[model samples]
Target: MHDSSHHSVDPVLAVLRQYFGFEAFRGFQREVIDHLLAGQDAIALMPTGAGKSLCYQIPALLLPGMVVVISPLIALMQDQVAALWQNGIRAAFLNSTQSSQESAKVMQLARQGAIDLLYLAPERLLMEHSLTFLSQIPIVLFAIDEAHCVSQWGHDFRPEYLGLSVLSERFPTVPRLAVTATATALTRDDIIKYLKLQQAKLFIASFDRPNIHYTVVAKNDPKQQLKRFLDAEHLHDAGIVYCLSRKRVEEIAEWLVQNGRRALPYHAGLDKETRQRNQSQFLQEEGVIIVATIAFGMGIDKPDVRFVAHLDLPKSLEGYCQEIGRAGRDGLPANAFLTYGYEDVIKLRRLLINSQLTENLARSARQQLDTMLAYCETTNCRRQMLLRHFNEAYSHACGNCDNCRAPVSTWDGSIAAQKALSCVYRTGQRFGVEHLIDVLLGKKTERIIALEHMQLSTFGIGSDLDARQWRSVFRQLIAADLLVIEPVYGGLRLTERCRPVLRGEQAIRFRQDAKAPIAVKKDVQAKRGTLSVHHHSKELWQTLKKLRQDIARQQGVPAYCIFHDATLQELIDKRPITEQDLSKIYGIGSRKLKEYGADLLRIMKQFAPDGIDV
Candidate 1:
């Protein structure tokens, strides 16, 4: 076994090796499992790729009875159960997708004590029949997946989750494990309170996904920008492109397909069958891109997604983190690129203000929007800014994000900010950035000429910079919280926060993106070394991937289910010769070793004859 702990192979490590085919547990996995195995409740705040499921799944294997997982969506449940089933674990799910006959079969299996793990949607679990049925079974534990949904303040709150507190009321003795990939302290507290987890041990993993290079660009010709990024960096990789609306998802997916890229659209607006087909296609096929809305990627378990690009602004920092977390699951390098424009911000503002959200919720939503906007406009390390939002402290620059890689240059923009603020104020703050910029630059546009704005003292004052530079300045000012776009008028308005800078009481600096078009070099992962495959291992790696793909097709499962690209990379790097060596590979659990060990060994010897154990 791979030595996870320094001690000899203990029971947990033995289970890990026999089942998951690994030597050791990662980070807090062992700690969380130990706590749960000791019959204590726990909450794990792990990142997307940090193996949160294993924390509960491993414990479930060791426990006496079946583990019940409260998952959010049917697709997510199916993927997780399929992966477990591939690992030779008897896992099943109950969802709307199942007929009454199928559901009854699964329930009968549960009653007979046959299933190791059972996944259910929250609504299904809370049903009177469902709860009564569970009372008859030997339930070892309850694992609440995506526990953040229980928080009303969270990005993806579900009303169905609020009823989960009854689990404590009904099964007071059963251990409960609540897990989420993204949750702030507030959301975390809400989850603990709502779920009624009694003195639950808290395990918070680092929110950093170091392998994903974060980049935010100004939204210029959005579809073209998306196309260029995909073509340049992820032409042959699997990825997701997130849009704010169903229409945009369909249009972008169609555009990608028309351009010879195999892309599919996913949204709540699609028929159930179509959505399931698109999601399955995305997960089961390699190099397939899914153009989707926010509704698509909450609990997807695919591990080799190469990138996630956003065509518009996300409503909250939590939402942004959760969406981008979908990439780089197997620890191979991935990329997250976000494109935001002035209209995106305005649209979000309108959504928050005009929606039926309560007063406090609206305020919180606005605050979240400001934080996300600041993230988009930051001149420092994107990773640092992102971690700080989650209350995780990173003392130095990450050196992995686009800002740290390119090192943005800055110039004194106090005068420019004051001039911009004055232009907005003198122009009555009722006009948007275009009219304001035209007036500032003394343009002879129809609106400017018709409004007679050329007569103001601030008119023609911003001649030192071009219109594009002024636009950047305005964008930065808004990001800095010095200005806000009114929801009703969609016009520029100065906030009280802008007073100090406008009055020359404080100095402001702006990033000069003229050096690079706000878009960094597309080869972010190659530079990071995580995605940089060695030349000697390249051929073998490709061969392993081909074999895994073929096996996946044969099994009717996603290629990552057979083996993730990261796992394949390790196979090439290690060049394992014997069954024992194969058993030491991270993702090669005992079941997989027995199933494909001979084929893998044959392939290894065929490609790397000199390294074989003859």
Candidate 2:
């Protein structure tokens, strides 16, 4: 008989090898997985594409029985189930789109211990019937996707999600896992308390995606800016164009299709079928673009999206990161472009001020918005600034972003920064950016005259720079850690870091903020090191993919479940000759080698002699 210990390999590593087919775990996946496998609750704060799904999915598969996943959006649930089905996994979902009969069938399967995973909306989980149904099943784990929604202090809080604490009392024995792409320290605490997962292990992955190039441009003809961005960066790649309004989504989708691109529109305004059809087209077709609002892409499972462009200011940096995370999941290079005007700030502030939340909550939300605005206006490395907001330090600039690729020139701003800091000090650190700019520009406006600040020694020291230039200086000062904005007081203040610059002991350099250069149109050139396989070898790869697809389809699994992109690349590169050689490849264990190994070997032999000797 097989030893139980051999069967009981580290539960996390076992799932990594069996389902996801990775030989090892990535960044906190092993730790988080182990925590959940030990039947402890967990809250994982990983960035997009950081394998958040694996943390729960692995533990669910490894435990004694079924794992119930509570998701927010129906589209997200369907997409996840479809991807899992392609991988030969028995996963199903109960959402609004399902017919009652279909829901009943899925419930029956769950009762018989046949289904391994089940997905439901948070509201559905709160239903009495749903609770009754769940109580009958041997649920080993309860997973909450997008756990930030549980906190009203979070950007995407949902009331139904707040009610999810019932799961803790209803099934006290099951471990719980809460996963989100982004969360601040306060939001993290709120999630634990609200979900009643106080005992959960906390895993916070580095909030960095080095492969995504972040860029923010001034809102100069945003439509034209978007057109230029798509033309220069992602002409024939999958991407999402986010808008704040439904009308804008429709217009952008139409414009993209008219410009010889495949595009679709998605929002709550559309009927369910239309939205689903558009989403399906985007998933199945190459180079398809989806123009959408914030309502789209919550749980989307697309792996090769090449870009995510925002036509207006995002609600928060967390939202922005989550949206861009949709791209480059396949470990490929991608881009995130954002454009916003001054009016966006006014509109966002009004939205926040109109909310009925407590004053402290609104204040926190506004601060988060200010941080996002600072990011947009920054001339420094966008990646560095973003990571810094999450309390993580980035020592070097990412060489891929638009700013880093073409760095902005810097001027000696030590004197100007000192003058600004002095003005804030003289004014008792209680003035906003406009008042500060007026003092520097030496404007004889009524407000300035009323304050009688023109007579101060540092009043007119910065008269050389205009309003826009002064704005850039202040933004840079904040980014450089010299100035701090207190949202509570609605004013600017100096941090201790500014003392050295004021004393002339530290020199301050500022990026000369200027308009982005107009990209000259050029003929497309092939990327270097991207190989064009021989026609025979190309056929072999295609045959291998077809075989994998056929087996996955027959087994009701995801295509990646059979072979990941890296594994496929290895097969093309190594062309393993024997079953022994095949077994040595990553993701190809003895069982998989025996099952599909000969077919791949035969295809390789048809194209090359000896079929890559072991």
Candidate 3:
């Protein structure tokens, strides 16, 4: 119900106020929108929760013809289109997930000029029929979401994304926008080449999600540690638990369900119907925790996810950031919790060696893994170290991370480092961490006895440190680049970086491992509400949620599609009575006011006598 004929000094802000109910553009949104509105191509490198969509969406509304958005997943397309419809914007998608009749109707709409924004998966959009159909339409611009997938160096590289370059070739006159959340120097260059955005104006937003309290703990009784994290903060909240394998996903999902949590498993291995059902449950319901592999992340549009925990390490820091970035998308305080150990490293390295990825890709993956390990072992400010990996600088320590919250103590570990390096060297530089640990602890197992006389001079020299402590030293050595995992045999080998330590020319310092379970953010939920709402009355909050849920269920969309929890919270705080006042609330746009404002205001009026304030 936006007034397209209304002319104002700043047309974009007028549209934003009419549609989004927000007073200002976040970060580089207005700049990207300005570039596209000026008939120039652009690239936006923004973080996950950043308003990257608005950068193109606003321009689409003001442009002459419909803008085609190239999205990655079918789930993402459906979620976005549903949300768009709620805001009174005309949007649709075509993919394999839809029936031919449904697709034909959307095509009919496009041909009839009844659609504003149309989304397509890369593979579908690049099809000959799809290209031919677009050629006849009055097309305007192209927006490529998740552009990092176009780069081979990116964590989730998709061959289909390479086909997107044809968009520039086929629609030569149309401007384009390539948007992504995480990309390294190599991936950024690759996106430019693949998307032909070399001449586009680039907008790089800061990658920091300051609201996320980062915490990484060494794996010790992982199940208990996870439970404590849940109980301490997100006991009944919706969150994601990422596992490295499908089996672990299933196991964790089952365990959580058995232990009185609403949990579900999602992975490629699950049958199509099961996967869809689990995903639907996660999106449509609240307080439902999803335990899944990396496969579950790309299309998650849920705004109120309270936490992202890693039971095992991710392949790279890029992947880690993207996954954890799923949390706190609503701009409320959230958490990124991880529990890892040396065993996790060994398993992942071995898997990498056995996988059939190309040699070039394998080398890149190894480097990414090494960087990720080093990050986990870092005792400095987590945010500063993480941002540095992205080639960005943070001038000061971020007090939100675990390292900054609880300053870890450092101690001299030169002797321990020397002993671990010597054991790797003395054992022919071929044995794995377990074997090395056995030798260091002077355990004469059958394999050790057969391979050695138990008489190597370095064999029992490391008995002063316990096995766990010795494992920590080895893990840290790997993190320090002093040791490398032999790809073929999954053994430890010395790197040149270890030479100084071996020769007693350099001293090593290590952070004493924090023995306690994860440190909980005591006032995190209190600062943000228990339900991530700002209201004090739990009863009124639940009532508003129930109303939103009812409307969303009737509309056959996620509850957030009706109005985000943030908007509901504002309704509580503002206690708007009239349509004009309702229009002033965040997320309550003109179209939403026409559609749901009556119901919302009616609900608020009933509770007005209670004098509630969010």
RMSD of each: 2.8, 6.2, 3.4
For model 2, residues 142-214, the per-residue Cα lDDT tens digits are: 9999898887766577999989999999999998999998688878988988899888878888988877777
TM-score of each: 0.95, 0.77, 0.94
Off by over 4 Å in 1: 1-9, 515-530, 534-536, 609-613
Which wins on lDDT, candidate 1 or candidate 2? 1
Please tell me which model should have the higher lDDT, number 2 or number 3.
Answer: 3
lDDT (tens digit, per residue) of candidate 1 on 304-402: 899999999999989998999999988877889888887898888888877999999999999999888888888899898888988899989998787
Off by over 4 Å in 2: 1-12, 353-357, 412-510, 514-614
Pairs that clash in candidate 1: 2-23, 4-24, 21-589
Ranking by TM-score: 1, 3, 2
Please list the C-alpha lDDT of all candidates, in the order they appear: 0.87, 0.78, 0.87
Give the best candidate by TM-score. Answer: 1
The runs of at least 3 residues in candidate 3 whose Cα sits more than 4 Å from the true structure, single-residue gaps closed, are 1-9, 444-453, 528-536, 609-614
Clashes of 2: 10
